[model samples]
Target chain A: MDRLRQHIEQITPLTNEEFEYVKTFFSLKKVRKNQYLVHEGDEVKYEYLVLSGIYKVFYVDEQGKESIVQFAQENWWMSDYYAFFKQKNAGMFIECMEAGEVLCSTLEAREKLSADLHKMEHFFRVKLTNGYVALQQRVKLLLSSTPQQRYEAFSHLYPDLIQRIPKKFIAEYLGVSRETLSRLYSASK
Target chain B: MDRLRQHIEQITPLTNEEFEYVKTFFSLKKVRKNQYLVHEGDEVKYEYLVLSGIYKVFYVDEQGKESIVQFAQENWWMSDYYAFFKQKNAGMFIECMEAGEVLCSTLEAREKLSADLHKMEHFFRVKLTNGYVALQQRVKLLLSSTPQQRYEAFSHLYPDLIQRIPKKFIAEYLGVSRETLSRLYSASK
Candidate 1:
């Protein structure tokens, strides 16, 4: 697949045998729209790469209000990252927003990959570094920007993302209420 | 020197020759209280390890109000990380709160070390992974907690830190203003 080829290229060049070895760990699964992929308190067993459709990662507070943290579409990766990488209980839930397919790999497989290939370890190190960079930028945006500005910035970055997801989910990600988002949206319009 | 030795031990075992090689890149510098170590827009050419005392990394808005982003004290490493690692203009200015001493290394020296020794590269990667983990926790805290809860969490995590930096700086890092911080501080007290 083009996606698999792209993913492999991001890491070190894999020999045909090594590629086959790594491929053994990945299992493909189909997800239905509106289905839950992971829930809070459950252990996250794998990191997934999306092949098609969209998924939302969210956290629910004690009051049962959900706050969307991120959305992953085609070719993007989604997981309860803290749980998957650090071996902890899920702090967030991931749900399918559209019928999708994903390639999944578990922690045990990742460990073997790391052990078998130093270059693979380097690939993962770079992956985590890039994640850290994104997280830092997100924190800065939360600190420096207003809700309207954040929404605008999000629109600019992912022009079709808002069109695909619900308004309430967008509000939650921006750390605002649905009503507030409605007002901002109406005002901007 | 003792602090430097301790810092090195926390990462990896270094041979005498390796230690000598590392020492060549680091120079001890004393920062006076109320003075800056790096400024916003300046190049972040060096990384500093706090040997003693306290420092704050903060960003000033267009309005000239400072928002603290990080604090470094004894045994902590401080830098405009976004700038230093990405080789961009500094995102924050680092300043000494109390007269402090730091063991400093330049970006060029670190690159040379990485190229010269595989062990050093592994050591740096491990250190970077630990830093990445801590930053991930910080991002989750920022996303999931209220300002009051965040402040409380910070105090719980770093009991000694409260004694070193002012309340306003802590509030800034938590994404709140001085007046609000003053109120929260008094209420908690």
Candidate 2:
């Protein structure tokens, strides 16, 4: 797909022939709102690259408490990465929040692409580098930031996400109560 | 340097010549306990591969609260990675907890190595993959795990670290009060 080309090319350029070869590894799937792409206990066979709409990757704990690991939007990647990498059954679920399409690729295909193309390897490395940095920032925020600080940082980083995602999920992501989030929302307004 | 070669070879095999070429990009540094490898507001120039001893990567907040981001032991890499990749001033500090040796390599050297050798690129990518997975797991724990769950997870994952790191620092890292961590410690025993 053109979007996939654009996404990969954002890191490294690919010739038409190379692009064609790379595209063969991915298959497109259309998803509907409230549909599940991945479910806990199922095998996580593919990681999705968002072509449109939004999705949440999360897990429910033993106490039946839900915690969102991340959200994926257009041009983003999503999977239960730990299970995906280990070839284990999923420990998380990816649920569609809006109707969308995604390009799915297997870990085998990803490894083959990287092995077969130096440019693809470079592209994946750079993307992973960026992802690693972002997760590090998130870890720090979760560790030390207060509710107010977390709300401010989230809004500053993802103004669009704030407008798009429900307030309750936003509150959960910030580790803040709904009342606290409501107060912060009112103050920011 | 042999350690460096061995570390890389754990992921991808390299010819002696390739290993020699790769080692040249790194310089060895001996660190003393309490020495800071990076300080907030300083330009973060290198990411260090730990050879021996322990180090803490952390940041101080406005109210002078210290938060431990990660602990590095032998064969681990430590850096203000966001700053290192972005070529910006460090927003965190890496302090040596025990006298040790580290192999320091600059961002330019890393890029050059990755560009020059496909094996090196694969090596870096694999390391980043592992690190990314570990951080994601940490984020999940921080988001939902109780202090007891956190302690059990930590001890299960890094029993050696439990013995090596100070109990106070471990409490901070787990985002638990000292008394709570102490109770967990006693209960575990």
Error of 2 at A59 (Å): 1.0
lDDT of 2 by residue, B1-189 (tens): 899988998899999889888999999999999999999999999999999999999999999999999999999999999999999999999999989999999999989999999988999999999999999899999998999999999999999999999999998888888999999999988
Q: Where in model 1 is the C-alpha error above 4 Å?
A: A186-189, B1-5, B17-27, B106-121, B186-189
Give me the displacement of residue B172 in model 2, in angstroms. 1.4
Q: Which number leads on DockQ?
A: 2
Error of 2 at B187 (Å): 1.2
The sequence of per-residue lDDT tens digits that candidate 1 reaches over residues A1-189 is 556657866756777777777788889999999998898999999888899988998888666777777789987777877677789999889999989899988988766776566666656655665666666666666776777778887878787887898898888788777898898878877
Fnat of every candidate, listed in order = 0.17, 0.78
Instruction: State the displacement of the C-alpha of residue A156, model 1, in Å, after optimal TM-score superposition.
Output: 3.0
What C-alpha lDDT, on a 0 to 100 scale, does residue B148 get in candidate 2?
97
Q: Judge the docking of candidate 2 as incorrect, acceptable, medium or high.
A: high
